[model samples]
Target: MALTSVAVVLPGRPTLFELGVVHEVFGIDRTDDGVPLIDFRLCAERPGVPVEISHGITVTPPYGLDAARGADLVVAPAYEYSDTPSEAVLEVFRQAHADGAWLLSVCSGAFALGEAGLLDGRCSTTHWRHSDELKRRFPRTRVDPGVLFVEDDRILTSAGTAAGIDACLHHVRCELGAAIATRIARRMVVPPQRDGGQRQFIDMPVPEIAGETLQPVLEWMREHLVEEQPVRVLASRAAMSERTFARRFAAETGTTPAKWLLAQRIHHARTLLEGTDLPVETVADRAGFGSAALLRHHFGARVGVAPGEYRRTFRSNERRAG
Candidate 1:
């Protein structure tokens, strides 16, 4: 479905960063770059009323929950975890869900969705601190605190803070295509997609420069995806034993060498498919999958579509959406 309209519910205490992420992705005017204009609405339970967001900052939304009707997407950003939206506010979500609009929650905003019974019988998550509470409050919902976000049945729930960006870009990629999502992510100065499975917290979140142990090795791995990178070779290059390298790699990148290489190869294949006319065999060679058959196996498993089908759909979507 084409997403032409978006509505964000302005809770009593919406965090600025979470609110800003939504506005950045959907509310901005990027028509010069060929992004379709969306009818973005900031709807409040009480229209034209002042609500202090954080640090005494206040905003007055011009529209009421009624204005959210018929929106293609409805968002509930971070609010106090303990706070519950009024029945009137939740009805807006219920109506949107019944209408098949995509619903998303950021951080404690999952509480609002949970209160609305939207998270029930679906896998969802919130911030780690509030995750137990979320599952406790909504038992039927499977809460995975490890991931950055969860999307099921048109509802997306993201972890705290910047994970909202990941979830939003994911939806953008899903509804539009990788091209549009990458465009927006570039404009925002962030990665186009971070796998939802990545751990929310990592010990070494940002790798050090000056050719540190794993950072330089990881850069080389991406540049050389067409080549084999066994753990022993990687450890030898990093001047560590395989056992030490394995531990540090997990701590630093949150995944093993083999798994990370596979992910990189898959993404590189996606980029090639989206931007080039390379044959499947050639693309697979460049992406380190060895052959078309192997590429099809992994790509279809991860992306839920064959390479040709993905390319066709993405190309068509870029043209139609642009």
Candidate 2:
């Protein structure tokens, strides 16, 4: 659907960062760069009343909930997690969804959608810190904590803070086309699309391992990414039996040897695609993917874009920066 209007709902004590993300993507006028102008409205429970935001700041929204009645997109930014949104606010989300408008929630905003019953039986996500609570409160919603955003049907939910930018840009790309999305991202000085998911940002504390372990083997694997690394060969290098090596590798990395190897290879290919002007086949060979087709298969599955498309987007960003 063509996006012409966006309505952002402000609850009590809203987070300014996620609210800024919505404004940055939709509220900005970039018509000179070929982006369509969107009618952006910031609405609250009461019109012309000051609503308290984070850090002792207050914003007076000019429009009331009626502004969101038929907007093309309805957004709820992060708010206090413990506070229950008013029923009037929840009904706005429900009515907007029923009216076929795209529904989006950033960070703790998912709770409002959940209360509105829009997230029931839908795959949704929120900030990792609140993911467990979201799941506990709404048993029907499938909360994926690993992804930057989850788009199930027309309902979209995003993780914390910067991930809100990723989700908003994705919506812009889907509705307004990649060129417009790229322009907006360039204006914001952020990537049009980021690689990996929330899992990459989550802090994983290292478990203390007493003696000599797979650290050396992992280092060797990184150094020789282009070389074939079968489990048998890797086990021999670690001076352990295949069974022991496999167990130890999984324990240390939280993934099997083959899966870990594939991840490393894909990461290496991403680096080459971003930093170098190599042919796809050459990148495949350097990253141990064997062939261009194989690289495309693995890279698309992991990165959500083909190798050539990734290169073009990366190069476009670099040129914009230059």
Candidate 3:
């Protein structure tokens, strides 16, 4: 049996919430439900040295850099805005990478990982507020300010505070299975997963309350995706010209209305695929795709797998024939 161990490194002025996230996911006993349990430890470069946390709590780690180097996974939790980690922390992270351990950073901890040169030429994300600074500081790292988390092979970086939870849950789902990850999410009273990327968090201009905007029409479009209509019809419903509506819709939703509608149609098609025994052609028609070929093309492009394959792969365990 393979033993999974995760070492969470603590630097000065650590964000306690991020540390607690690591403990919640890895440090606790989770074997009651037959889920894989991890050997998780809190480590620091200078072992046994008292450290002050964000919420007036002080902590001391029994393990040091040696523990970090030996763990299967290394996690760096959040750091303060003004903090720059010591060379000791950076060197330990580099050595951990050299030893082939998976590296994860939550929120501002990506700064430390970047300093260690792991994120060079790699796509990464941080709290949206620091994306500019992270780009300026690490010119080699491609900073994506909009994603909740990015999984680039062995290195994963998450955005903002609560996004750490999403990234950790994603790891659980990837390493274990959706069933185990869903169980863990239920225990934590959080959603099992979120569809789409982090485009929802990207800043957008809110519609004026007194002015006519796309809000009502957008909700109506969502309700009537099965009614095949052209962009002109949608524009008419929103009381704007076709070109104006298209631009405004993109501004409001961070994507074009046509693309958004296609995404919603694909989402509905996936639900039908997972929940029903309907034929692919019928599912396509119901999702307003008009043909299975179109559905297959878009579905495969978006999901990286064909529809029938996805059905067989992700079919609910209870629904499977024994």
**Per-residue alpha-carbon lDDT of model 3 for 228-315, expressed as tens digits?**
7688999888777788877677666656777778877876776677668999999999988889999999999876788898676657
Q: Highest lDDT: give the candidate number.
A: 1
Number of the top candidate by TM-score? 1
Q: Give model 2's TM-score versus the native structure.
A: 0.67
Query: What is the Å distance of residue 199 in model 1 from its true position?
Result: 1.5
Screening candidate 1 with a backbone cut-off below 3 angstroms (N, C-alpha, C), the clashing residue pairs are: none
lDDT of each: 0.86, 0.83, 0.77
The full ranking of all candidates by TM-score, starting with the best, is 1, 3, 2
C-alpha RMSD (angstroms) for model 1 = 2.7
Write down the TM-score for model 3: 0.69
Each prediction's total of clashing residue pairs, residues at least 3 apart in sequence or on different chains, is: 0, 0, 0
lDDT of 1 by residue, 1-322 (tens): 6678899996558888899999999999988776788899999988898888877898788899998999989999898756678889888888899998999999889899889998889999888888888888999899998888989899999998989999999888877877778888999998787777767763344533344567789889999998989998999989887987887787776677887788789888988888789999999999999999999999998778999999998777667776
| Ten-residue region with minimum lDDT total, candidate 3 | 313-322
Per-model TM-score on C-alpha atoms: 0.89, 0.67, 0.69
Show pairs that collide, candidate 2.
none
User: Which model, 1 or 2, shows the larger TM-score?
Assistant: 1
Cα-based lDDT at residue 23, candidate 2: 95
Candidate 3 positional error at 128, Å? 0.7
